[model samples]
Target: MKLYPIKSGNFKLDGGAMFGVVPKSLWQKTNPADTNNMIDIAARCLLIEDGNKLILIDTGMGNKQSDKFFGYYYLWGNDSIDKSLEQYGFHRDDITDVFMTHLHFDHCGGSIQWNKNRTGYEPAFKNAHFWSNQDHWKWATQPNNREKASFLKENILPMEESGQLKFTDLPQTDMLKNSPLGFDIFFANGHTDKQMIPMIHYKGKTICFMADLLPTAGHLPLPFVMGYDTRPLLTLDEKEKFLKLAADNNYYLFLEHDAHNEIITVKQTDKGVRLNHVFTCNEIFN
Candidate 1:
């Protein structure tokens, strides 16, 4: 199996919102912010190429939103989803599965796109089965007030409307059995319900796709939870458990939103699991 890092695009978000309860003096050291306190983040996705299946982990924010909507996030960067796929000599039609970590616009928006006429939306990956959990689907479709803005309907609904949507059963351990993808799904509820983090076993190394649960290496600390998380207390609990496992087992965390750092490993320091080392994906893959 081969894995490729697919960079969708880059966008700026309020650093304070990204790192809840964490002081600017602390987070700004790593993810420096602008005068407006917005920090640039990459909407990085992962692609898995197995024998017959080509699975894409997440779709970054697509270019379908109106200019007014995009004005807020300030999406900038030359690396697009198409360009990233072409780097690996593939196209959208080549994907067989689109496993969404959640239904947030930045995570699943690129799964759908505007039609030629701009009258309706269509599935971006025509040949891929878009995978989302049933509970997450319901929660996103009927979003609460706090998260309603992030769950855009244009980025969703089209998957099911196109008959390419498939819901994975909760606690997806059995779903990954004997799968050539060489990954186990770790479900956590802190950052939106049923966010699936793919724990991949490659060449005797375990690399986990740290979705919003651990957006960047700067978020390694226990209290660096996001304000967007519906349940911050649950996030603290989940992070403690996951960080312990990651440190003990020497798992390389593949950060999804970190622009500069691709992967990092943690060690059990006196201050708890702190970052031990940082490396690029290509370096480790090589």
Candidate 2:
């Protein structure tokens, strides 16, 4: 199996919102906000190339939203899903699975696109099956007011409409399972209900796709959780448990949103789980 980091695009988010409860004095040191106090964020997705299956982990925000709508996030960058896929000599049609971590616009917006003639929406990956959890599907479709803004209907619905939608077939008793794509995933509910984090066994090392569960190295500390999370206390509990597992097992965390630090490993320091070493996929894969 081969894994590739896909740069979908970049956008800005309020540093304060990204680092909830954490003081700007602390977060700014790492994030270094702009004049508007927004921090840089990447919609970096992952491409898993296994026999007969090309799995895309996320799609990033597509270019379908109005300029006025996008102005809020301050989208910036030349990188795009098409360009990123072409780098590997592949295209959207080659993707057999589009496994969304969640329904957040930045994470899954590229799942659908405006159809030809711009009449209506259609699945962006025409040949791939979109994977989401039953609980997350419901939560996203019937979104709460707080999260409704994040779950844009255009980014969703079309997957089901295209008849290419599927859900993880894990039993209720299991926290992790062997995915059809030949990797293991454990679900976390703190960041949003049933956010699945992949634990990939790559070349004798475990590589985990750290979704919003751990956005960046700045979020390695227990208390620096995102304000967008439905349950911050649950996030703290989940982070403690997951960070322990990550540190003890020496997992290579493939960060999804971190722009500067791509991959990071944590060590059990006196201050609890802290960022140990930073490496890119180039270093590890080489």
Candidate 3:
């Protein structure tokens, strides 16, 4: 199996929102903010190539929105999904599965695109089966007031309308496991309802896809949780359990939202699970 980091692009978000109640003095040291107090965020998705199956973990926010709509995020950089795929000698059509961690626009927005005539939306990955769990599907479709803005209909509804949507067949019990893509999935409900985190076993090491569960190495501190979490207190408990296990097992956490850090190993420090070493995929996987 081969893994590639598909960098769609970078955007700026309010540092305060990203780090929640954490003081600027603390988080700004690791994730320095610009003059506008916006921090750089990378929509770093993962691509898995095993035999004939090419699975994508997430699609960064697509380019279908209006210029004014995109202006809100203050997007930067030229890196795009097609360019990233081409870098690895692959194409969007080659993807057999699009595994969404959640339905947030930044994660799943690239799942759909405007049709040729601009009449309606269509699945961006024509040949890929979009993976989302039943609980998340309902949560996103029938979104609460707080998360409605992130659940854009254009980014979601087209997958089901195109008949390419597939829900994971795992029970709703606490922390279920499933390996539909040959990688075990660890489910968490704190960030959103039933968000799946992939635990991949390859080359005698375990690499976990850190989708919002741990956005960046800076977020390792137990108190540093995102304000967007539906259940902030529950998120603290989830992070505590996961960080302990991650540190003990010496697992590599593949960061999704961090612009600089890609993969990191954590160690149990006096303060708790702290960043140990960072790696580019080429240095470690290649």
Per-residue lDDT over 1-286 for candidate 1, one digit per residue giving the tens place of the 0 to 100 score: 8889999999999999999999999999989999999998999999988889999999999889989988999887799989999999999999999999999999999999999999999999999999988889999999999899989988988999999999766654313432334468778899898888888887789878898989988888899999889999999999998899999999989999999899999999989889999999898776
lDDT (10s digit) by residue, model 3, range 1-286: 9889999888989899888999999999999999999999999999999999999999999999999989989999999999999999999999999999999999999999999999999999999999998889999999999999999999999999999999886755555564677888877888898888888887889889989999988899999988888888888888888888899999999999999999999999888888899999777688
* Candidate 2 residue-wise lDDT, 134-235, digit = tens: 989999999999899999998999899889999986646425578776788878888898888888898999999989999999999999999999999999
A best-first ranking of the candidates according to their lDDT comes to: 2, 3, 1
Local error of candidate 2 at residue 227 (angstroms) = 0.8
| Winning model by lDDT | 2
The CA lDDT at 101 in model 1 is: 91
TM-score of 2: 0.98
Show pairs that collide, candidate 1.
none
> Residue-pair clashes per candidate, as listed?
0, 0, 0
Runs of candidate 1 exceeding 4 Å displacement: 172-182
Superposed Cα deviation of residue 247, candidate 3 (Å): 0.5
> Which residue ranges in model 2 land beyond 4 Å of their true spot?
171-174
Candidate 3 regions off by >4 Å? Answer: none
